[model samples]
Target: MSGLVVHSARKVDADGLVDDFWFVADDGVIIATGTGIGWHAAAQGPGRDVVDAGGHWLTPGFIDLHCHGGGGHPFDDGPEEMLEALATHRAHGTTRSLVSHVANPLASLRESLSIVADLVAVDPLILGSHLEGPFLAPSRRGAHDGAFLRDPGPEMVEELIGAARGTMRVATIAPELPNALESIGVLIEAGVVVSVGHTDADYDQAARAFEVGARMLGHAFNAMNGIHHRAPGPIIAAFENPDVTLELIVDGLHVHPKVAKLAFTAAPGRVALVTDAMAAAGAHDGDYRLGGLNVTVRDGLAVLSGTSTIAGSTLTQDVALRNAVTLVGLDPVHAVAALTHTPAHALGEDHRLGRLHAGYAADAVILDHDWTVRRVFADGVPSADPHCTPARFRMRYSFCQAGLFAYAYR
Candidate 1:
């Protein structure tokens, strides 16, 4: 009888948008749902709190499978810094995240993983740690420190798995490296979601890796081969695989809008929109360090100090969703799914966290009419002040069709 009930909202989930929807949450799980005044019946209890959404948009909380850092703190720094960064993203609708660390020495990587594991024990929002790591191809090492790149050795894999202490949710590896396939098997066997990334792997090699339990392709078309008339690369390999999820950094800087549209059109529900973000995310653009590599942020784009090699982004999940809708020409429902269920499914958390349904986790984001985050809740607890007025960004509709789409859904 004690719970939180939200009413008078436009609900979006994997199924699509529902008008005048309401849901109730108790003990961190959704317990009931309906449309209209039925929520009034549950609103009378002593321990129940009612949230009048006032015709706002409510969707399941966002899940970011690949995120390095945000709010001027890198995940590799320490537990406090990592938490500080997670707070920033949480305000922008990322309710749960896999803390991603770039390539570092084995000892440093292990230390970071251990710290994240400890945090995971204390914070339900900290899903686990993601190692975008030492097991990368040197040529494809984007923002990762070059000196720390190495082949995925079995001993190193075992050490990392131990360091994470059952909290390693995902690990990125170069599938073409020697012993890489063996390492993929090792990590997958240990319950890690193996991701093919930072690699020179061709179509065949990438397909083989996917066949052997590598379920994710990291940041499509960046730091990897491109699709050509004759050379269909890892992106195509991922597209062809029925079970693979392709991660797209839809910040408009990482991949072109047309190409991103192609990814959405080709992959459909399989595209997981990720913020391969760094320390500069949710912070002012300036000098920063990513995985021990010097990065300069100019015009909101992060790159190696003096090179054109694009580094990680400063994007938050809300902005990525905006780009998916306004820039990449995706339906709002599919864009929300890319941020919610697709990534949650990537980490095998769809059973609880991805949808606004009975028996699901009580995580949600209330967005304004233009898709700006108005409020966020993790486990039914509000993460940011509801009174904080969100800054509105003007949407450029060059690629978007002219229409009154929001009211049409209702």
Candidate 2:
């Protein structure tokens, strides 16, 4: 339970950026935070680990609500491959991540969910599993396996829910499919966040999904209908609903920068910047597989082989943050909040995992002037080395199995 203090930097969080702030964490929990000379006394304390951030940018560790894999390893592979991907993103300041899985057969998906559940039990930073799969629409299934896309039946839905064992944090569904709305109700009943995506759903249908408890739009504007002025698809529908959080892939490929800025303006605090990144992220441009689909990455853009469909992205959170500011013209504080608080709020982990305040988890990232990650602290332990090792914390964030939403689900 050693004490650690980071000071003399620009701190950004829900309170916006503050100059020359300091915070002290004991064990794995933030105990105190202040500004200016208050930290000088702590710096001289015995058994204290003090880091002078040197006026660098400091913010809460990035949280990826939707990410498949990175470092030449897909999450669908297994534990070893998933760990490899986690390590790769961890170095880039993504301290918390939901291991996303592409569409696969029902049996295969259940097995993968079990693997992720086991990992969540051991690794505090692995923030459970997000099933972006089999319950999607065939016509809008971008890189997902079309063969496995099927209607969500009560029995099938219960099986998948049972397989996850309370670790299934998110499930994506196309409201146009048969029983999809009912399935959304079931997932919400099970305390899992339902997202609308990979659908041919029009405005009314998308609106209906959100009204029924679907609170997220997965990588909006890609793999779904775009705004047609008259049509006003899911993007517009999501913009109208205050309860919804729109996931934007700020890689500037899946979504244009101008349109991305529009989302930021329209939704305000609801845009969650996600890296729908595949195995090729943080790796070389080469051939990769997303679920059962083959992908080719060239010029850092991944697309289906011999086709124009963007399979996924080769992006990490650090690059996404920079793109939000430089390419999309968003304020740096808003961009950082999109990476931190917005995603954490989307998954209902905003209670502790997102902000850099007292009583929050000791997780943060230190970025140099160019916004590249210079160091990461997970559970109050410094990951100063480029190589990342898994951290174990006492009060780690996890799926909401405690029924905190008992009234909402009731």
Candidate 3:
């Protein structure tokens, strides 16, 4: 790869704002960063490529830890479909993402994990895979097919780990299931990040999961117990634990703005803003399905066709960032970190992925004053033109296999 320098920008990252900031990237990593006219001297020499941002809002590229699909495709499909699914999200500034799979037959789930492992070999942007299923509470199996839900038995856990081939990043489990604690230990031993979700577990039950090494509250306050005066619930249990990262879907549909703000305040830097979007995210609102369940998308809200149960959402990280700032009343620095740094830390990649400092990956997003994505870069190369029009494929049964915990019947 060639060298890249983005100059004349107002950069906001972990170190906060820097006026007229400029950075240099060579061989796919940030080499230098400073404020002022130093870039002029660097550009004076040959073999240097530079971009005049004209004072756009620069931020680290958004990292989404929990997303099923976007565009008109879902992650459960093959590689071509996975890339198609991410095109809309990539244009909207999500430079790195984890492919999440919903519940399925054990054999099918193993195949999905191996597929992600292969993709990761070619695309570092494909961080890994996140399993959101097969071990959740049936009572709270929001969109997941109840038939696929099972106990997190040790043998079953080993089967998934072997299939992922070291690329399984996270697995969401309901802690109340029988033998769940032992399964959590086995998953942790294999270096998988465990998350508690889609459960009827109370505060103490959820707390026990956390103590056993589950570090995330999967899409907090949803598919789980709600907080009451006497019952603090799982979300409260997450808040009380400093090591926990609270995943908040700030789409205004899944979580209220006030409630989202409360999470930011309670968890502070521990909140990760995720878009639990399915195939309709950046596509037209219409008929769709998630994992064999018919879904209707009206006004961008996706729900099971015959019921009020939300299947997933039609959201992208750009809209999520805009909402975090405009609706939730958060500072740009904090809001941006929620999208970038927090999630990176949750996945234990903060050393190189989330910050815009020297030695970090040259991943960044240039935003307009209103927070809309204008340009994006990953590994020193600019993405295709931000004015992207995704090819609308005919919605089919294969496309509906978009996965997330609490999905539909298969």
Mark the 10 consecutive residues where model 2 has the least summed lDDT: 401-410
- Give candidate 3's error at residue 374 in angstroms: 0.6
- In candidate 1, residue 90 scores what lDDT? 85
Clashing residue pairs in all predictions, respectively, total 0, 0, 6
Candidate whose TM-score is highest: 3
lDDT of 3 at 188: 95
Residue 163 in model 3: shift from native, Å?
0.5
Record all residue pairs in model 3 with backbone atoms less than 3 Å apart, i.e. clashing. 102-403, 143-406, 143-407, 143-408, 144-406, 144-407
Q: Which pairs clash (backbone N, Cα, C closer than 3 Å) in model 2?
A: none
* CA lDDT, candidate 2, residue 152: 90
Candidate 3 per-residue lDDT over residues 201-316, each given as its tens digit: 99999999999999999999889998899999999999999999999999999999999999999999999999998989888788876765777889999898988998888999
lDDT of 2 by residue, 237-285 (tens): 9999999999999998888999999999999999999998899998889
Q: Write the per-residue lDDT of candidate 1 for residues 1-410, one digit (tens) a residue.
A: 24788999999889899999999899888999999899998899778878999899998999999998888888888765786677778889998999998999999999999877766765677899998898999989988888998888888899999999999999999999999999999999999999999999999999999999999999998989999889898999999998999999999999999999999888989999999989899887899888788899999999999998888999999999989999998998999999999999898888888999999989999898888988787888767643342222111111125321111100
The local distance difference test score of model 3 is: 0.87
